[model samples]
Target: MSVLQPEVNITAGLQYQGSQEKALVGVLCTGTSCSFLYINSVLLFTLRSKPVFCETSRYILLYNLLFADTAHMVTNVLLFLLAALKIIIAYIPCCVLVLLSGFTDIISPLTLAVMSVERYVAVCHPLRHSAIFTTRSTGTAIALVWAYNFIYILVQVFMLLYVLTKIYIDLHLYDFCSKEAIFSAPIFTKFQQTYHVTVFFAASVTIMVSYIGVAIVAKSASTDRASARKALQTLLLHLIQLSLILTSTFFTTIIAAYATVGRLTLIRVYNVCFVCLNILPRCLSALIYGIKDQNIRPVFMKYLFCQGRSSVILNKK
Candidate 1:
């Protein structure tokens, strides 16, 4: 019956593939990642080395935000850039690494939101602020925010793998968070039919509400012109943060739409904005921090000029 032995080995021929250009791109991206690494490293180094803030709550908050940014930059930005460069490694599934990176990325924004709320309370609700957002409470709140974020993203990763394997059973592809493969997965399809879009919309709504809640709570408690003015500035800072995240969110959603809708017109625009979004925060934070943080301004200027002059000399060397 098996005389001629009709046999095919698909697995034998299927090879994991990428190109030299991809490796080069990954290297270039790795280099870019290193550049930020140096800058952020210096920033954090300075943060730790300096006695920049003494007995100041605002300084503490700035330092906290810096930590969030640093975490996001190190974890998310690095993984993403690596993934873009396609550096698959042993002992780690690319998907898991990528998911963890995404999870930490979410933590950055969530932490920022918490920081904004804390600041709003300190400025706007100065009376109950200590009781609510005391050091312990603030620490707890940050812990919970991070815990929830990781768990939530883990669920997404789980759903992407399991739900799709059960449903689509066809497109057994792994790029779940990708715009192209999102709805194509069977589990994602079921998720879409069930609560996917609803939950996404809900999250967006919550971020909006969080902003408004902070604004109202701050404004309602303002008793004088100066207090009201302080409330507004704090609110504006939060709004700027919100705007930064919102604009990036806009780019992500728009790119997703283009992927889903096949809108070629927007591909370039979305990609451009996405790159800007990735780099803008680091630069913008420096600018905002320089303005809001008096201690950092002079130090930053000295470093900027000193570093510039050194580079000029090095080029001659």
Candidate 2:
């Protein structure tokens, strides 16, 4: 959602200079997104093709996380493309895009929190981990995450409708469509800020508590030291991932702070922040779990390099 606003502004400045820079930046952004998309797609296939991955509760949650991240990347790239192209969309379509983007944005951190708790349970309650995180319960948890976001989107929709009914505006947007542009009402802004703060706070607390619990269990003599250490490392990775995702939500505020520094400086900073905060966070899961996880790394590498048959043979052995 922050993509459109900064992109539109940046694109406008590029237009003043020439079309080449705009096109170059567009290609760069799109190509980067496509590369990550391909990597995520392959990782998804790897997760699905293996029976072991499909059957495990942790892997199931990982698939959910990757799917959400991929969807988020796609939505963001689409929004960026729209802004870069200077395409003006009608209000309703724009709303749908924004809502989808917001939904995807919220899901990742929540999923990370769930994954953290799963790791905690595995470490602290090893005997009950299997019983507690059964396939059915895992599915239910994912469903609840989606359902919660759906309800949040519905609330935004109602707020939008209420605002529309109260005021009259052109259906066609003059500026590039964005959540801020469409839902510019003070009430909507306040509500979004409050909702984001609450959700993030809850997720942060969940992840922190889970990490603490896992760390405590890791030190206990009764626990399997190796397993406890692994779980603790996983939880730390989750915290890092959560931190990246959380930083992305502050994109607008960061941009705002840099506004008075001149357009050129702003553009340079924006591009840096966009890649680091927005693009990188979406793809970090693949790098983190895809490469760092020993079980996933081999299969991921095989599929990544298009050696699927060979990977199957190895797995069979």
Candidate 3:
């Protein structure tokens, strides 16, 4: 029988900071997941009650976004829990979760871009909005997004598996499997870096163009000021969410690419961004888009009260 020995090179200060940051990030991620799921659940229940809500194209897109974000946050929470508890999930399952998280990361941006386009069309072509973005068409677009993300991620996973055999059955080292690990992986090729850059840039351009088109159309739509205003609010939230996540991703990539980790300052900075900024977007999204939505708020309130009453009864018993 044999045991694989390990080495620990990180200093005590850095280790403390890293653990603290991970714990904070895990707490934030849990909050984001709970809030997002609660609001989406209530909103979904409300949508089910009203046939009109189910029939709207924008609502359909929103539903897809909610689902994608929930999955993304759940994977994040799982990763954080595993790290926090020092639990060694089998290598295969851990890798699968990591891939799922990456897939949703791509899906979030794609969904945001599609949402921006939907708003652009609605604002720019009010008369044709229904004909252009029907319920069926919106559903098909969402399906295509999922299909593309699945195929792309699956291919990348296969490529990585083919190139890096060491990672196949190894234990999940927190320092190695954490956010910083991606940059150091031997199999994280130039092609993968290019893919991320391309996705970010393309999604950014799409969002910008859509926002500009919507603004231009809004300028002339004096009668439809309300719809235009709502669209702008939604777009603003999406942009904020996109900026937060992209900024964290970019900073981590830059640190990994150019900076040396021997410097404690650089490592700490990378850890901070990785833990804090990385998970903030979903939390903000739940607040800005889900909680603040006029239609969803009432349903959420009802759900909250019902839960409160149920808890009170349980406590009394």
- Best-performing candidate as measured by lDDT: 2
Which whole-number lDDT from 0 to 100 does residue 83 have in model 1?
43
- Per-model CA lDDT versus the true structure: 0.54, 0.85, 0.69
Q: Candidate 1: which stretches are off by over 4 Å?
A: 1-40, 50-61, 75-92, 127-131, 164-231, 250-253, 256-271, 300-317
lDDT of 1 by residue, 1-317 (tens): 36433433333333222244445545655566556556555555445546645224445555556665666556545545544644544323445554554554455455555655666566556688768765566667667867876676767768776755666444334432333334345454454334434433444454455556555664553455465465456556655665565455454555656666543335344335534665556445545665555577766665645674687789999
**Which lDDT value does model 1 have at 39?**
56
TM-score versus the correct structure, for each prediction: 0.61, 0.88, 0.76
lDDT of candidate 3 over 1-317, digit per residue (tens): 13322223346656888778767755765675566567656655555666766888877777777677767767776776665566765555666787888788777778888989989888878789899899889989999999988887888777766656755534555443443344246456565667777877887888888877777777883638788878887887788778776775575556666476565556456445545665556556545654677876665566655774687789999
- So what's the TM-score on candidate 3? 0.76
Instruction: Give stretches of model 3 more than 4 Å off.
Output: 1-49, 165-189, 221-223, 254-275, 305-317
**Model 2 Cα displacement at 94 (Å)?**
1.2
Whose TM-score is greatest here? 2
